[model samples]
Target: MTFVITRPCCNDASCVSVCPVNCIHPTPEEPEFRTAEMLYIDPETCIDCGACVDACPVGAIFPDDELAEEDEPYLRLNADYYLDHEVDAGEPKPVRTPKLPEGEVHVAVVGAGPAAFYATEELVRHPSVHVDMFDRLPTPYGLVRAGVAPDHSATKSVERTFSSTARKKNFQYCLGVTVGEDITHDELTERYHAVVYASGASTDKRLGVDGESLPGSVAATDFVAWYNGHPDHADDAFDFSSARAVIVGNGNVALDVARILLTDPDDLASTDIAEHALDALRSSAVREVVILGRRSIADGAYTNSEFLSMRLVDGVDVVIDADDLELGDELARQVSEGSVDSTIGSKVRLAREYADHGAQGADKRFVFRYLTAPTRILGEDRVTGVRVVRNTFDADAGRIVPTEETSDIATGLVIRSIGYRGVAVDGLPFDDAAGVVPNDAGRVVGDDGVHVPGHYVAGWLKRGASGGIGTNRFCGQETASSLIADIIAGSLPAPTGSRDDVAGLLASRGVEPIDSTGWAAIDKAERDAGRASGRPRRKIVTVDGLRAAAGG
Candidate 1:
């Protein structure tokens, strides 16, 4: 019987490492693993030992007979790889390591996000290797804890894996450490054999329109951070007094923000959402959230899981234009006709259900507005409304083209969730147009055409903004492989001194980094604080609070 890998696989490849016969085609070490949309097991070579089934963290694996009718497609998807390729079962294969190493190496990874955590995990595999992980925030996991919507707790489970990796003695987490401001690139390079920058894109891409700078206008990134209790955004205020709000994007983040505003405050109170934001949301008067997409519904950017979660949220109305719901192209037709279960199909089903309920002028409405471009923000001081231009779908070009016909939508608050842009790290060569460090695979590329030796990047900083949390595992593996190759090639530079020397240098420069024990204290404090409130864990949302929790 065939075993299928479903969408929930998350690309973490936890199953790949556990297959005794190396039956998993794209092991994390394989070159194809980097680009494969998802992992596939070679059915022909399978011993059906069910080792992979037991190893999967997200329950993405299923036997053929047990496969749900909707997931039956994956059975063939798993078998297709073996049909085109030959598998030598008699040949001896090297055992795979969930952890592997190249040699004696010292590495410093910036940021404690998923990317950094994965890099550290890979780096610590070496018997003689050590890693120093840095983050500006006192706590780590970047967006996993801060940017992810509270309702998506399953997504945040990645943190437990990250926590497990952080426990490695070789992996040192340096929290509350600002790279450019506190410690310079030169200093880090002087202390480690190589430095991997996993610091994710921190800024939001702006919409260059009038009234976007109004008082009530805010970037969805900051709003997300505020509600998630990100220390940087703990005190930031989001005005939800307006009965109607406009969200200018069609991505998962837009859906996340909309659901957060509309979800029952009582439901959120039990989650890890910041107490301050919870209090604000409890009193929120927001009744309608208009999610605007410049392109047609077909081009909207939320995944199936995210869209389904939004639809399943209680006490919210989702509206979609019936005319605009027509399938656009061959892929869209396939999805609409039920040949595939794409995210758009889920959205269409959800939209139809909401449409069937009929529009009630009073209850909260999540209007999914398609083919609209915000032309101007209409307000004197604070946001009162927005001017929008009608957009026509350019099917040939596969984009939205704005038209002269314009109209106004009454909105008290405006949230731009357009996109995320990476900021330049000091002393690193950044491609302003791409909003990333110019890198070849994983090596940092300089403007003068020389490769920056031992400097690397992964995740959103290496690849453009894309993929889910598990995507970073492969991204980080690639970066780590490149780093290991450089070390094996004797191209990586050696650290000038020991960890003590590095810490002394930073302290001399008036910069103090919280160590592992310190981070543990902070973690305990957050958990204890959450326990006090009957929630999962309330984060320490400020530098001072984090420092104090860390026993400073």
Candidate 2:
């Protein structure tokens, strides 16, 4: 029997590399990888070598006969992917590890997130190279724990892969430490040959509207972090008691917020949503959510898979206005001229279908309003409503130009989910406009048009905040390759000594680093607490709590 990829895929795509015969659909190379809820295996092309089963970090794959009774639908899901789509059973390429230097290599990776883990994985492939990862949080796997929507449990399972990466030989984790604060750039440069910064975009783009600072108005990033139990946002509060909430963006984050606000609290009992957030959602008076997008379907950042995913939310209904679903002449021309793929067409079709078939007596609903930009949040102290202007697409300028027409959506809460931008690193050169560290490929670029010696970047910090988890794999490889090439060229000077010296130095400086073993204890504590409540893992949202759980 063939294997099926179940819900916990998390879209890491590690399985694709290990399979001798490629059977997974919507690989990272394809557009489908962006929004696919989870990757599906083509049962028709399955040789059952069991490589995918082993590579899957979340244990999402199972032999057709071995699937639990509740997961029987996934068997069909896997088979159905093949029924409608073409399969390419291409042979796998030979596994290649980077050529390394003779002696031991030491690298310090700032930010113990997906990109850092992927880079760590790449570095450890060479037996001589060792990696010491640093992060501000006591926990590892940065945004996988704090940014991803908790209801999307499958997406969060990528942490399992990272946990495995932490166990590799010569791998070290120094949690609850900020690089610029606890350890300076000069210190790291003196201690290691190279440093790879995977520090993610920590802030969200503003709505740029007046009254955005109203108590009822919040950034989607903060809201996301708050709901996911991030320590930084642990004490943040939201006015979910509002009857209707308005979201001023239509990306995946907007969709996630709408889904979470409207979802039945009973469903989240099995998920890992923060306890306070869970209570907030359960007590929420919100029943209708309005998601506003300034751009048309053709230019929107979210993909077809995400649009389709919205329709699958249990009990919640999607409301697509007929006018919004109707594509403009410019968008239609772009689609016909092949400027964009059929993905937009698929999204337009789904919108039309939902518009045609209105909400079927569902208590909760989400209304998607396109081509509208928020002008201001209407409020005195807290948000009372939002004023928006009709936006006309300026194809020539490739921007949305505001029209004279203005309107208002009455709601107590307004959430801006426009986008995210990275925080500035102390010594790293940052391009403020792009909100990323200036880099050519993966090498950090300085104002003098020279590569920053022994400095590199990967993930969102290298590029602006975009792409999924697997996207970091390629990015990490490129940065790792560059670092390796630099080492071979003898450009990057080695550290004075090994990690023992560095460890002692940290101790003398009063920096108490949390090692991988301590992290494992924290993991067990979280899981154990979650088991008591029949949930995934009850997250530790405070620094003290996490440290205690980590046995600090």
Candidate 3:
């Protein structure tokens, strides 16, 4: 049997280059690669070299026979992709590492997340290129550490790859240093040949409804950051006293919040979730979480992998009303005929399955309400309920239109998980509508559409908040390529200042940037603490605590 690409697939295409028989589909060269949730292996390709198993950074590949019970579905899912598309199974192409110019090049990257690390990985490949990565947080791996669900350890395993890049001789990290405050953009440009901003979307998109600012109404990003122990939201509090929680969007983030709220505290206790968040979850009275979507199920933003994962949660019932899905006879016919997109077909099938299989009367329940939009959050001081209006998916118009039907969902909390928006950098040109830095293929663009000299962007900051962890690899590489192209063209000039000069300037500013050694200390301390508790590393949720763990 062929190996299966499981849910943790980062879609970085690392396995594609290493596959001996080219079994993995949606290669970087394929158009489907851009939208594919995860790469799949063709079951018909039988050499079974197992090379991808070692090449995958996230440990997503497993032999069909070796697959865990929870992941058994992926075996069939991998083969299903081949049913629709023909498998080429061509010879693997040789991997190529780009050669760099001879002159020494130093680039400063703002943000120590996956994007920055991936970009650094590209640049540091050349012995002549040096990278200095900066982040305001004392820690690195921005969203990987602060946004990913703590229970998704396989996804978090990608930190190992980032750590490898950190160990590169030419790379350096300047943590806990604010760019606009401690050092200006001009200062960074003066100190390096180029500066690449990878600081991702830090803020959430608002619902723009009345009573949204109420105490119990919060953004899903805040909840994610809070549970993941982000220092900025470490002290944030949530009232889980209400039995029902209403989520304004039906995205993966909403599912994550619902699962965490309804999950057995014992299951989460072993994760790296924040101590305070864990304590709050343990005492939570929330038993039912209603996820509202303004559009039909076919237009759902969440991947089928995440939607199906809800079924695996023990002691939790996934409730989906068949009528709410709005799956007309035509859509069902398309799904049955295999004419619809495979991703959408799987999602619709899974949703119908959930709807058909009535709830087993589990203690906790996650309900999906589609074609519903929240008009207002109802409460005097805090969230009491959400006034939502039912919408009809005007398939002919390809838009959702409001109907006369309106109802109130009784709940203590309302979480808007609509989406994330990037914050504008103080010195960079920002696209207010897109919530991204205006850029053309990773090169920063000004208001006049001219490229900003020695300035570049990667990740969500460049393209808006889209794609997943592995998507950043190519995104960062594109920015790095732009920087390289600038370097080759002699457009990027050598720095006037040196690293020592920058260090002295930071010292003068009283900004004690945490070095790699200090971060290692903090990591080790957390792991050691977690080992004592028989859990993964207990996260240091506060900035002061992280700094203290890093030996100040």
Candidate 4:
């Protein structure tokens, strides 16, 4: 019997400590763990201990008997880990908790994203710790509120957890606070025992193609932010009057953009969509969305669950080329037979349904165009079309190779959903290539091989852009452990200034950080304003609006 790790693992390695037989290889303590997407349970070890299943918070581990037909490949993947290594079926390592002193320790976390919230929650577990969290926008939950598709209400529920954490007395919520521009990192470090940089990846990875700078062309990240009422994108405009639109990547984000555009305007209006964006969408003439992928559909970036959700959306036709539906291997054949519940099977079923009933005259259609790479945007002042080249799959090289053969697709707007990259924070060491701060576990690394004591990272900044909400829990645990270790080691700095002193310093510098009460007032005003607007809860989508609503 074998056990396999699925997509939900998030590289957190909680399973590593729980496997009683030590069959789970590449624990986070191991050098290779950072590079592994998920943990693997060696099938040949024959211990069959279910300790890992109990440890995984997200339920990523599965026994051989429980493995769905689609997950059978993971059985082989897990077995392969032991092909060249000595098997270790020894006793599991014990779980360790942080040790802290008796006094309260003040900490400042920059960014109101999931990482920051989780880190603060973990820190507060040490009864003697207090957290002051700051964000540039008045609202919190960086990506949950801004980047996630508004239609994904289930994922949006993460905000509830964050809200609950913010209610803690030791945790302070400071909105409308920008670190470098409003307050310096040096000042934060000076005022708190430790400072954590959880500011998530803010910028989109641009598609460096000609005409990408056109007015109608936009990054999917920015578009998501605009529709989701992110303050930064409040004034941004999206043109959907064109019959057709083109998306450059085939990630879950691309699927999100496509679904939002293709969804019924009436359905969207009832949700928490921004009033302005919803109004624009109601009048949108968009009929077709072409999702361009450099590789075959088999290697698309979106997960099975996301694709399934896209297919389940009402009043939208998911179109795909019939030729592309040909199963190339045994796994694909199994997927086609419905013997598997894998991601590809979900997408294949949707594609087959759409192809059977052609979407030529449908109200809205999302078409998946495989083996196509965007060469350039075609337009003068606004996006009018896209030039695409044929691509050949290089199985050996594990990448899609673009060919010279080209085609043109008419489109009114272009959205690139390539990926996200982290940015350098002031007074922190950042890796330009990896788009991460150099860190060992949670300890921020600096030149001369010295660790920046009391500074830490979690979530995407520490592990890159991957995993879901639950992923942050373990990431936060690791960072918190490191923090407690530092405190126990007497390496953490003592808070030099009082709360009033920090506030006075900020006021002197013309920067005002919103207190918890102010955030509550802003929250109330938004809910009231949303009630008036006849939506679930309309957000004050601008910094000025939030400030005004908060009576700042």
- Best candidate according to TM-score: 3
Q: Which parts of model 1 have CA positions greater than 4 angstroms off? A: 1-9, 19-54, 58-103, 326-362, 395-399
Report the C-alpha displacement of residue 179, candidate 1, in angstroms.
Answer: 1.1
lDDT of each: 0.79, 0.81, 0.88, 0.76
Q: What is candidate 4's lDDT per residue for 248-304, written digit by digit as tens? A: 897878988998898997888767888889888888888889998877776677765
Model 3 steric clash total: 0
lDDT of 2 by residue, 1-552 (tens): 898876556677889888877888777667666556567888778898999988887677899999776567566556655554675789866666657658877899999878888888878878788899999899898888887787777677777778777888789898888788777888898888888999889888997779999899989999989889999888998987788999988787888888888888888768899998998888899989999988876556764456766777788888877876535667777656645444565566567778999888888898998888898899897899999888876767866788899988889989899888998899888889999999887889999989988899999999888876767766777688888888778888767655567667778888788998889999899999999999978988899999998887
List runs of model 4 lying over 4 Å from the truth.
1-97, 325-361, 395-398, 495-500, 532-534
All candidates: TM-score: 0.86, 0.89, 0.97, 0.81
What are the runs in model 2 whose C-alpha is more than 4 Å off?
1-11, 21-54, 58-89, 333-340, 394-399, 496-498
As a TM-score, model 3 comes out at 0.97
lDDT of 3: 0.88
Worst 10 residues of 2 by lDDT: 338-347
Instruction: For model 4, name the residue pairs that clash.
Output: none
The TM-score between candidate 1 and the true structure equals 0.86
Model 4 score (lDDT): 0.76
Of models 1 and 4, which has the larger TM-score?
1
User: Which of 2 and 3 is ahead in lDDT?
Assistant: 3
How do the residues 1-552 of candidate 3 rate in per-residue lDDT, one tens digit apiece?
A: 678999888888888888878889888777777678788998888578889999898899998899899898787678778778776888977857767667788889999988888888888988898888999999999989988887778889899999999999998889999999999998998888899999999889999999999999999999999999998898899999999999888777888888888888899998999899999998999999999999889878887778878988889999988889885557768887988877888788888889999799999899999989999999998989999999985668756799999999999999999988999998899999999999988998999999988899999999888888767887888888888888878888667887568878999988889989999999999999999999889999888998999897
